[model samples]
Target chain A: MTISTMRLTGVAAACAIFSINAFAEDSSLTNPAISAVLDGYYQSAERPMSERVEGFGLGHTEVAMSANIDDMFYGKLTAVIEMHDGETELGLEEAFIQTLAMPYGLSMRAGRFLSDIGYLNNQHVHTDAFSDRPAAYRAFLGSHYFDDGVRLSYVAPTDLYWTMGVEAFKGDNMRAADEHNERDYKSTGVYTAFTKIGGDAGINGSWQAGLSYLRNENGRMTAEEHDHVAVLDEHDHEHSHSAQYTGENTYVADFVYKWAPNGNYKYQHLTLSGEFFRVTDFKPLEEEHDEHDAHDDEGKDYQDGWYLSSVYQFSPHWSAGLRYGQVDTQMMHDDHFDPQKLKETEVSLAWHQSHFSTVRLQYTNQQGTNFDGIEDDNVITLQYIMTLGAHGAHQF
Target chain B: MRINSKQFLPKALKTLTLAVTLGFISNAQAEFNIFACEPEYAALAKELAPDARIYSATTAMQDPHQVQARPSLIAKMRQADLAICAGADLEIGWLPMLQMKSANAKVRSTDQGLFFAAEQIDTVDQMKSVDRSMGDVHAKGNPHLHFDPKRLLGVAEALTQKLMQLDPDSTAQYQANLARFSQRWNDAIPRWEQKAKPLNGKKIIAYHSSFKYLFNWLGLEQVADLEPKPGIPPSSSHLASLLTRAKQGDILAIIIASYQSERGADWLGERADLPVIVLPMSVGGNEQSVDLFSLYDSAIDLLLAAK
Candidate 1:
């Protein structure tokens, strides 16, 4: 089917769902708050970008339902629907139950949910000022990370805002390797801890800073295995594959500052945010034939990346944003791949028709060194995000 | 003899818990911590509980409906003994998020620690059915009932009862304060009405339903709204249509709240040659509006000047 036809069908289905929800007669306090986000984008570029598809495509869309289970518990479930390579795919994004009234400012959540590690990690993509997350997130976290986990968080009693949280996850989704190897974990694989502090800068401004750490019990990440494996190139030619680097630890530091006239965000505002990521204690994995050659894999490896972004709302409906990100990856000595560094810069303008809808136009330029001959590319994209039904409140 | 480490740890924890509980009990008796979603409620709270430590979540220069659930608010909510807000979905956007994130068992929607000012009093403009397409309508009613003196007295009575229930030790003090405030407020209401007598039957344009109760109380008519839809901004096409009605010269003035952007009202005022008046919506809305009494005085003075 044509892309336009598919888009029309998707929109029709969403509207139908909304009408059914609106007309439903069953009203009870236990009934969940239902909402849906519809996201679509059109891109023009010479080559497919890292996180963006070429031409017309449906982006990340989600339907979520949430309710307080009782006075003590709250539950939420979100299902993601998107187009991948001209085919529609559906997946569960989040399903969690959190404590509502834990004493001493403590709360616990369990089930599959996004880890609260960085400023932008747990927030929905539809709430983002830009069409995409920064390059650091795309490279290290595969855009957004969610897994089966349990989390416990505590808010301090002091006047200044401070929170600390810990999480444990089954790392199947977070593992860098798509194909499992002998070193794969059997059970709980990823553990994380994070602390955040924030306060009002003034009547018109607020600032928050956070530090986070993640440890992978089993192998954490895999880089290109460039040694002996042969992989087919996009041009239908045989090429050496990239090697794997099993990471043990990752750290993230993030900060955000927001300002508006007299704390009023209805008209004009500015947001400045940045995040830095580092991966350490990485050990390159050898191919199956060299399983006994563990001595060669003992060398430690490291990688780091960071991104900075600012968005200014010039008027009630229009906002412009600029972001720059860079990532450096260290690879083993090989013929197919060398240590690579990628830098990306993005500028975007968003028109918020209302609180529920946004149309964004963005331009991105990426520069890469030792990136399989695809060094530099410029891409432009137009995207729309529309919320239907009971849109929930945004969190900081 | 060396103490067993495991047993000693539990003992230490117990002591810590007792100390913290004692500290909280003492603090509660000394001063009740109150979290008010808006400044008007904070002013009301201060009247009833003079010794209470009050925190207003939103400033006078903020649209309460558009407040962000900032971390500082969550922190304040966590420490509050009681939360006072104009419910009826006025704070639906951010209050629930704050309540959940605070995790302070005391202040959930169903908890006694939470009080809704609008729910305690009758409101105007209630609807049986509502939709977002209608632009941010509340199914319960217009939530900006604080401007109506009669309804505000009802809220004050209900809030005094609530505060007494939460802090029973200060019930006599609360009753005394309520009596004094109600007497003064009742007296001032008539004076305000007398001053606003000139505004009766006068027509004006407004930005939102923020002053619905005020208009109803003063016998004023809202001829038009700057916004085409309740929440939507005024478009050029809608403004152009309003220009025709504006030329009829029935509109006494273009009125906007202190927190609202004046662009739309200014445009209409310029084109129609009408007086543009910015009214203080609540306490602390302007320098002169330092309290509830001053708030009403400032609002009436501004509207009278425009008239």
Candidate 2:
């Protein structure tokens, strides 16, 4: 391997080892966890520069608006035009709405959305605890997990614990880019619960756990999709031609442990949070010519991922934080994935300027067979948040 | 913390995004209950919740700290679709009393009947606590977190969330209005902060704990209060104590609101030989302080002005 490749691999390996070591030690929160998640849609409305903070299939021209109309409602509307170097449009970046107004910590949301999958899945631009989202989110969901559907969510009320209710679209173009895959729409999911006990030091947060099931007519095409059957000759290439995924069912079980103690004045507190997501009991089919056969990987192919991060607030005006992310999955293969064994590590840094704005800079040194055994990327972001009106009521 | 006539109407109220939204809706057919705790929320309700039945007991200049057992407020609370108040204990003294007595099955802390403006608005004086020695202090930080617009974001959010819930029919309308109003409100933040920034760290005295939060916002140093206890007026020894501390402190001014008595403030100011500026604490107390922005505008000018 080239010197540069060797160095990169070395760093990635070290990160993996450090991540494992970190698991052995407890996290320390220094900032408030109950902090504003800013979705800074960067824009230079009047500036002449064509590119300021725009690059890498991201939008420089993004618009975001937030408002607290009264004591009961708070929301933000975001829309962006995305493209490359000088291309007028690659597509739209974000077209989503987050409305938090309902009795019992329940929020009714509709519009293009980001799949609230793993920890970093739906972390908005402004609200991202770290500057950049994890690679798993990008690889799995990409820019758009676009699927139009309504979602109902509720945070169960229990001191030092968590409970969530979610019903969302089971297709792509949901929270990422809005795209349509000709698959029969499906609605399948149940609520999940979370708990984090023993987080009184005002540093360690509570824990989280939930059970959910989902079903979908996931395959986009029917048997008449094509007219060719391939007989495989042991080589894993496209030796045997066939549509691998016909129809499938999916389920997930997730859990998280946190020690967030922020939310005081200036959020000058700390928090340690981590979560795991596991998939299970799903089946798929492959078709060629006129015959049907089970997909290469069927009968309970499970994949899972998790991450642990810590944030600390020195004062309300200023804060600093660090987060580590990991992912392991084998959804497309023929075997189940033991999430605990597969690993990748990411490190991050963040600075909150105020309640509404933050600047996060992060570096990820990942290894261990994830990302095709290569990992080297830097993500930097500045997030801003603004709300006007009475201020959403939280006295309840 | 200053009194003037500019507040007769705040730009915030006159062209409220909520009010204008009312005009935009061709269908003005729904009726709802609006519970206004402070006169300001009442003022907004009058404009935006015009069709809704209005409810509130306090006026613009009354002592929120002293308002008690008003049957009218209770009746209003009982039938309120929304109970909006300057939260953070600003209305605790009276609201809890009213919430208890009205027995409004609908307006519980857990229901739509309860709305905290402070919660909706970003609030200040969050960490302050009352002590036995601090006269007229709200044991829970400065209940006057409403004095700053930055804190107002919380209030607006809470208000928006509640409005959307209670008036689900109006969610879309409320959202649009909220977005526009928030735009305007946010637009005004930098100007307001700049206007108030100069008064940081100024030393002043007050008749009660009324100025704690306002002082905090302006970064002012409070020297003392005219009253010796939470509800008690200044005593002879209290005056004596003031006399002793007056000379050493760089006391620049003394703030007294119109609803409060002038006797205690006058004596204290006379002793300190400083301006006994009578200020308006809420809307309608004075013309300049009638509107929200002007209320703050006059406050800064009054506090920072040369004697």
Candidate 3:
């Protein structure tokens, strides 16, 4: 057998062994459901050689264990093994316990988990239709937002589906966490609230819309010292610079629509979804100048982004999708520091071999401004995802 | 402390009025709500509790093995007074998550309000040892027990008892409904058997093991399966082999459920010069299959027509 096939066979055997052991050890008790997903990809990007991430890579091998702790509680743990910077790394993706029966129609979850901030933030990468995350998500939320926190949600007793939820987190996200300044870290750093409503539009269509708000109270970042010299008559003077930031607030709105003829998804279906995000109140940086000369570091920082995508399943095995994403960022007050705006367009075609496996080919074209200047890149990726054991169905 | 008869009388009268208003409001909102995982259980629940609001998570056109977690399903499950399902892990993919997310105490697995129709009947084709190679087989045996009329009657009785337990005031009405339904169903059984006599001993091919109960009930022999194993799609080699078998033996027809893909059955039927029959696997699969009795009637009609 080829090397890749042999490796896949080994991985499959290991997964089977793990599942059997888990089941045998807890045969008397309720055996936890064991599932594993393997994702691998071949990607090539047309960019500067130093800035390109092109090659065959293992995306992430995710293993999940879930079961009912008792009649009143349910628990799930997911761990992922991935390749990072040419080294293999293992990390805990999600570990949470959620209430099965709570008073007053309240359900609560606690522990480390992905934040339900936007439409696709909580979903794993393998579940995504595209090979990579949207540029808007990557720029705005650093791919995804996960933190140690607690969430409480209420499902309204109404004819239509209406739910409201709130969460409190440690605020260890891209723009929130400050690893250098430990003493200034707030205990309840980030708080969020969201409301979602969904209903059947007709016999073949359904839609869901949600509004969310997130606030980070205190965040810190260490800005490196930079020195500038004026070269008018060959005279040079050095000035020290450092900065700190406090926090930020964000708002997001998302909507999703799906249609399946006669309520049968096996033949033909269509899904359309979009999410818009706006970030503001990025507290002004406090600049520290070492020289006696006064330096003004006043700047307005703001970011906004949105993504829209549509996936059409024409047959039981074939599907195609297209996505458009754009992000804008303003970090400095200087007019010469052009505000960065990045736009990306991607298209994908996939073949679902069965319920447990999929092979996809995707192409992305990205063009816009970066910190350095105008930038453009083209990326092509071929990915394969396989699931073994009892993987749960995805939520709409 | 001495004697305030006028004030006491007015206060007592006001309290009585408030209590009566609240009681009326609670009574007005007491209508039972049931959430069924499949159309068959929903049809059965409708028979037992005609006044209760019913919601079925999946239609007959959809696969019962897996389902998307729709928001409406969670909402209905949360408000359900009773949750009924064909639960031999038939809904293992989505039901557990729905139940956990709903956080509704009334219909938890351990509660009296939860009813599993499979638990009321004996299952067949149960494997002694289950492995993935068996192709997604249910560990507790086959869960499609609704095809057999006798087993369905037993499930109805059990479900009626549960309805009585949840709503004690409706005990008399539920019992009466059960009696009437049982009598009507028993009378129809012999008539169906007489009509389906021509189908007896006929060898057929099936897309999946979904028709096991129906075959067992009608004494029809399932000679071969288009799919190599349960839940696995038919491969070219498997279909070719079945076609060769068809030439050697007398195969009556190729049968598939409404929810299954018809490509394999059509492919095999064309080459073997046999008819491909699509049967309503559950209620509401077609316009004619509106309820439990009609679901079977429609299925048998399709099967007999193929013959």
The list of candidate 1 runs beyond 4 A from truth reads A1-31, A46-51, A178-180, A220-246, A285-300, A331-337, B1-30
| TM-score: the better of candidates 1 and 3 | 1
| Model 1, CA-based lDDT | 0.80
lDDT per residue as tens, model 3, B1-307: 6769989899999999998898779757868999999999999988889899999988888878757676778888888889999988888878876776567878886356789988888888776667776677887888999999999999999999899999999999999999988998999899889999999999999977888999999999999988787766788899999999998758889999888889999998998899999888899888899988898889888889986
Alpha carbon RMSD to native, model 3: 8.6
Q: By lDDT, who's the top model here?
A: 1
Candidate 2 per-residue lDDT over residues B1-307, each given as its tens digit: 6655577457567779777687557335435777777766765454344456665555545566544333344445555667877766666446754553344445666464577765554444444434334433443355565566656555666677777787888788777766766687778767766876767777777876666667776788878877675556566788778877887758777787655666766887787787788776666657777556566677777776733
Docking quality category of candidate 3 according to DockQ thresholds: acceptable
Top candidate, metric DockQ: 1
lDDT of each: 0.80, 0.47, 0.75
Off by over 4 Å in 3: A1-30, A46-53, A175-183, A219-247, A283-301, A331-338, A371-374, B1-28, B235-237
Question: What are the RMSD figures for all models against the true structure?
Answer: 5.9, 20.8, 8.6
- Model 3 chain B poorest 10 in a row by lDDT: B125-134
lDDT of 2 at A54: 40
TM-score of each: 0.89, 0.43, 0.85
> Considering only chain A, what is the TM-score of each predicted structure?
0.84, 0.53, 0.81
Report residue A292 deviation for candidate 1 (angstroms): 16
